[model samples]
Target: MALRITDECINCDVCEPQCPNTAISMGPEHYIIDPDRCTECVGHFDEPQCQVFCPVECIEVDPDHTEDRETLEAKFRRLAVS
Candidate 1:
């Protein structure tokens, strides 16, 4: 599943750089994750790099944009090529 940054974010700015897909970006209030670009680091790492490096632990699975591992992997492949 894609991951999302919640309101609990402290804006420490650690999560943005960790996203391999460049899915995380500055939102109006805090950081936001684009579901289209998010693959939970499927092809890049065992776990989502953003989630792993997030100091506030505000990152979590996006229930509104659910996806399976295979789907994430496919997205990763597409992203890698482009």
Candidate 2:
């Protein structure tokens, strides 16, 4: 599944750059994750780099954009080609 930055995010500028897919960006309030580009770091890393680097622990799975591992892998593959 893709991830979302909750309102709890402190805007510490920690998770944005950690995203391999460039899915994370500064939103009006805090960092937001684009589900279209998010693969939970499936093809890029063993774990989600954004989650790894986020100190506030505000990032969480996006319930509104849930996806399976295989789907994430496919997205990752597609992203790699572009």
Candidate with maximal lDDT: 2
Where does candidate 1 stray beyond 4 Å? none
Give the per-residue Cα lDDT of candidate 2 at 30: 83
Q: Candidate 2 residues 2-82, lDDT tens each?
A: 998999999999888888899999999888999999999998899999989888889899999999999999999999999
lDDT of 1 by residue, 1-82 (tens): 8889999998898988888999999999999999999999888888888888888899999899999888998999999999
User: Backbone clashes in each candidate structure, one number apiece?
Assistant: 0, 0
Query: How does residue 42 of candidate 1 score in lDDT?
Result: 89
How good is model 1 by TM-score? 0.96
lDDT of each: 0.91, 0.92
Worst 10 residues of 2 by lDDT: 13-22
The pairs that clash in candidate 2 are none
Question: What would the TM-scores of all predictions be?
Answer: 0.96, 0.96
